[model samples]
Target: MIKFNQLRKVFDDGTVALDGVTIKVEQGEFVVVLGPSGSGKTTLLRSVNGLVSPTSGNVRVNDVEVCEQSLRMVRRKVGMIFQQFNLVGNLSVINNVLTGSFSTYNKWYSNLYIFSKELRIRALAVLDRVGLLDKAYQRTDELSGGQQQRVGIARALMQQPDVLLADEPIASLDPMIAYNILSLLREISAEDKITVLCSLHQVDFAMHFAQRIVGLSEGKVVMDEPQKDLTAEYIRKIYKTHDKGLFFGPESKPYSDDQLVTWSEYK
Candidate 1:
């Protein structure tokens, strides 16, 4: 459903975020992007929906060139979740979710403020799916962090996007809350058959949830493997030693570099 070929993202300040990276994601797959703080994971996720355009290379989703076409339309097919739940604090939960369907409204005639009854119905349904139906009428700022995050998910689901890009979706939450959110996302993907691509800080969480893993370091893909085939030692090389849980550590296993890499999958 999504493909990136020779993808390179270079900022105006000469920082190359991504370099010659290539990845293909199938429909209905749950993939995790694992990396350290400045390892280009966010850049890759933003590029899928044209939030961050590639300096060179191509990003195609559902056969549409993300860099070439109108970003307004591309974003409709790609939904992004940020580490911070980017909710409008003053707006009601239902109204925030309503923003996702803004594209369907006739912008020429409406100021994107006047929502139809049908739109409201759909927004409520999405809120229910995220377990936030009761909070629909409440101000977003009044809710807990976890509830606010659920609202964010509801907003994304309202778009009916085919591919979901989560940029450190669990970074802001506690461990239990983060697990619940991950489980919610995975369940929704399984039931809806949507492609789920997420960047994660916790290695154990990714291993437990993601079907496949893509590890990045210094703007390059160093490890890409099915979760079952992955080992702590192999994950170590993806990021430098500073990345603890990702490599062999107290939580991870004692991995060694001698374990042969699965090169056939890359081929």
Candidate 2:
């Protein structure tokens, strides 16, 4: 469902985000990208949806050339979720979700009128699927962090995307809330047959939910293995845990959401 060939992304400051990376994903498969800070995971995900254009190489999603296609066209079919829940603070929960359906709207009606009945009904159903239908009328800023994240997922689903790209989606929530969100994502992947490419920092959760894990470090793929074939050594290399002491004894670092949010200092 997705393909990347020699993809490279260099920022304006000459920082290379993705370095000649190439990968492919099949339809209906859930893959987890594992790496510490500065890896190419975020660049790769944005490239698939045309949010971050590749400097050279090609990115194809569902057989369409991502770089060549219009961003609106690619985004309509490829959904993305961020670590921070991206929603309009003033808009109602349902309205934020309806924004996701903007791609399916007609130029004339969407510009002059409100949402159509068909789109409204579909939005409600998607909100229900994400367990946020009852909160539809509430303002988005009124929601708890976890509920807001769920709102983000519901908004993405309303797009009816063929591929879902989640960039450290659960990194902001507490462990229990994080688990709930991950489980919901997994359920959606199974029931909807949506291809999921989620980047995660939590090793245990990635191993638990993802069928295949791809590890990147220093802008390169260090380990790509099925869950059953992975080990501690492989994880350590990707995360660089040797001198970090995060995996040490009882006094070691704890896996807190705050730490995940403040990733610039993970080392």
Candidate 3:
């Protein structure tokens, strides 16, 4: 349902965020992107919704290329979750979720933040799905970190998107809260058949939740494997020694340079 062909992103400052990367994600598949800082994970995710245009190559969602002309259509089919829980502090939780429905309204109504009864009902349903129904009338700022992220999920669901893109959704929460959030995402994907492409820093969480894992380093894909074929040692090889902190401990088996596989091999 999503495809990236030879994608490359080069900023004016000469930083190449994505380097000839290519990847395909099937419908309803939960794929996790694993990468450290500056590995192009966020750039790749943002590219899907045209938030970041590629310098060359292309990104396609549901067979439609994500260009300036197709951005509105592509965004309608894609829901995004951020690590920062992007929400207006003063807005009510329901009001925040209502923003996702702006595309469905006329410009005047949308500009006035005037939602129809049907849209309000739908927003409430999505809030309920995220276990935030009671808090819908409360201010978003009063919620806990985990609760705020749940609100973020509810807001995304209000779009009724076919694909969900979560960029480090669990990066800020505590371990248990993160686990619960991941669990909720996994359950939603399984029940709704939403194709989820999420970027994560935790190897163990990705291994437990993702059907397939795509590892990146220095703006290139270093590993792409199904859960059954992904060994801890193989994943350890994807990260350089200095970069391997919590993912790999000192007792883990070391890998030789010859054993490493390049992105070209995947082609």
lDDT winner:
3
Each model's lDDT: 0.83, 0.81, 0.85
Cα lDDT for residue 113, model 2?
Answer: 35
Q: Stretches of candidate 3 above 4 Å error?
A: 242-245, 248-267
lDDT of 1 by residue, 91-124 (tens): 9899889887766677743354578888889999
* TM-score to native of every candidate shown: 0.90, 0.88, 0.90
The lDDT, on a scale of 0 to 1, for candidate 3 is 0.85
In model 1, where do residues sit more than 4 Å from their true spots? 108-112, 242-267
Candidate 1 vs candidate 3: which has greater lDDT?
A: 3
Prediction 3 TM-score vs. true: 0.90
TM-score of 2: 0.88
The residue-level lDDT of candidate 1 at 220 comes to 94
Total clashing pairs for each candidate: 0, 0, 0
Q: Among all windows of ten consecutive residues in candidate 2, which has the lowest summed lDDT?
A: 258-267
Which lDDT tens digits does candidate 3 get at residues 1-267?
899999999988999999998999988889999887888899999999999999999999999999989999899999999999999989999999998877656878867778999999999999999999999999999999999999998888888889999999999999789988999998898898899999997766777788899998878988889955665465655566433334533434444435333222311
- In candidate 1, what residue range of length 10 has the lowest lDDT sum? 258-267
Order of all candidates by TM-score, from best down to worst? 3, 1, 2
- Return whichever of 2 and 3 wins on lDDT: 3
